[model samples]
Target: MNGKQDLSKVSVLLVEDEAFMRRLIQRMLEDLGVGEIVLAQDGGEAVQYILNNSYAFTLILLDLEMPRVNGFEVLKYLRSAPDVGNHDLPVVILTGHAEKERVVQAVQYGIHGYLVKPVSKADLISKINRAMTKPPIDASHLK
Candidate 1:
């Protein structure tokens, strides 16, 4: 059923303010055999990391609530980057937020997937794998 998410070469970027959450997600991604994981504390760092780095990451796990910059803003920025919106870069909004508005807003911002907080290793790993193997959205829909 196309469940074989070939993620052997996937690189990940995790943006979260909480240290524990960040570490937990990192470990979970590692367990999934995802190659290369980087952490960013805020939207600014996330933006800088993507800009400074030459290779585009396979996925980005963004937290909704962050200081200085938020997930929505970061998603918007990433989509606006040259050759990025159409690129097969998956971004998942993983946070504690459950509001319908927040979820809708995230979807509108062009992320690949969304997962609620307190996520277990199984859930986290599965979501990331799905993002890697699944096809990305159209570029026109991103803006």
Candidate 2:
């Protein structure tokens, strides 16, 4: 799939703690022709943004670790919050090489996909396409 064309109308929420990585990913998203990219430095800020904003996001690219709320907490909130209306929203986890346990937990939480740190542009685009086209995850089993 051509990411630039496919993503042209899609808005994304990027939750990353590191400044450099965030900027890098933002550039990659821009290059892919993503419509609007909303950035959150950490999970706390991301949750706040989700609560306050009425705009719908096409996808969420989230880092596993952060200072305040952490990605897992954010994922749980998204899945469980009655008013959020984003339980089915596609979420892709971003993790380092050592975070195997976290990745497993994220899968149990119904993550759409995941990418290791220092993600390549090709991989990012590929994952985004896959997540966008993949069927929604059923989190009811978790209850």
Candidate 3:
């Protein structure tokens, strides 16, 4: 994916537990020309937001660990919930570790890509473009 592609139409739902990391990524996305960015402090907040407006965002950047609802649970809800209007919504995991096991597990839930912590602007652009342009993963089996 080209790092220069315009992203003025993209909207992202960013769900992270840490305040600092959330702010950092939000700034990165803003600098990248993303049209809208919604912040969710944790996975629980993300779930509630999704329940009410699942189709509003173009993509989701989700942290794997949290206090109450984890990224895995949010992924499950997004992929399997009967009420969600857009089951194929693109998701990218945001994790501190890139362990093979963890990445593999996230793949089962149909994550588009992942970013290691302290994400670079270039890597962020690439992943977002790749995720948005790729065909949606079929998660009907999650139902």
Candidate 4:
């Protein structure tokens, strides 16, 4: 995409439990020229970091399966938490499997998009572009 240069201003919050996967994705993002990337070990850590630094991110790449808190809980918090400023913040799920029920649940909770495991840099860029172009999801009704 022509926006590779534009990615220099983007800040991404990547939430993944697996260290190897996390590093791999981070490196890809960096290679794509994302300006700032923050790492969270799991949903629990991601939530805490978001609570304090919600404004620091332009996008969230979330992993559903986690040790604690989990992606769904974080999605609930983002969509319903009174303290959250940007309820419509762009979110992309980084999932290993695209289960029907899980996808439905995620959409109901308001994810912008999702990427299957073993993400390619091209796929990552495409998802990010699509998510950014779309308007924010109003999942307040789901609360």
Clash pairs, candidate 1, are: none
lDDT per residue for candidate 3 within 1-143, as digits (tens), equals: 56567888898999999999999999999988899999999888998888875448899999998888999999999999998877889999999998877777788888888899988888889889888988643444333
Candidate 4: tens digits of C-alpha lDDT, residues 56-107: 7889999998876889999999889998877888999989988867877888
Which sections of candidate 4 miss by over 4 Å? Answer: 136-143
Model 2 alpha-carbon drift over 4 Å, by segment: 136-143
lDDT for position 15 in model 3: 97
Better of 2 and 3 by lDDT: 3
Tens digits of per-residue lDDT for model 1, 1-143? 12245566888889999999999888877776777888998889988887865756878999989989988888888877684434346888887978867777777666667789897876777777667667543445534
Which has the greatest lDDT? 3
Query: In candidate 3, how many clashes are counted?
Result: 0
**Superposition error at 46 for model 4 (Å):** 0.7
Residue 93, candidate 2: how far off, in angstroms? 0.6
Distance from true location, Cα of 56 in model 2, Å: 0.7
* TM-score for each of the candidates: 0.83, 0.90, 0.90, 0.90
The predictions' CA RMSDs to the true structure, in order, are 3.9, 3.2, 3.8, 3.5
The parts of candidate 1 lying over 4 Å away from their true place are 1-6, 82-88, 135-143
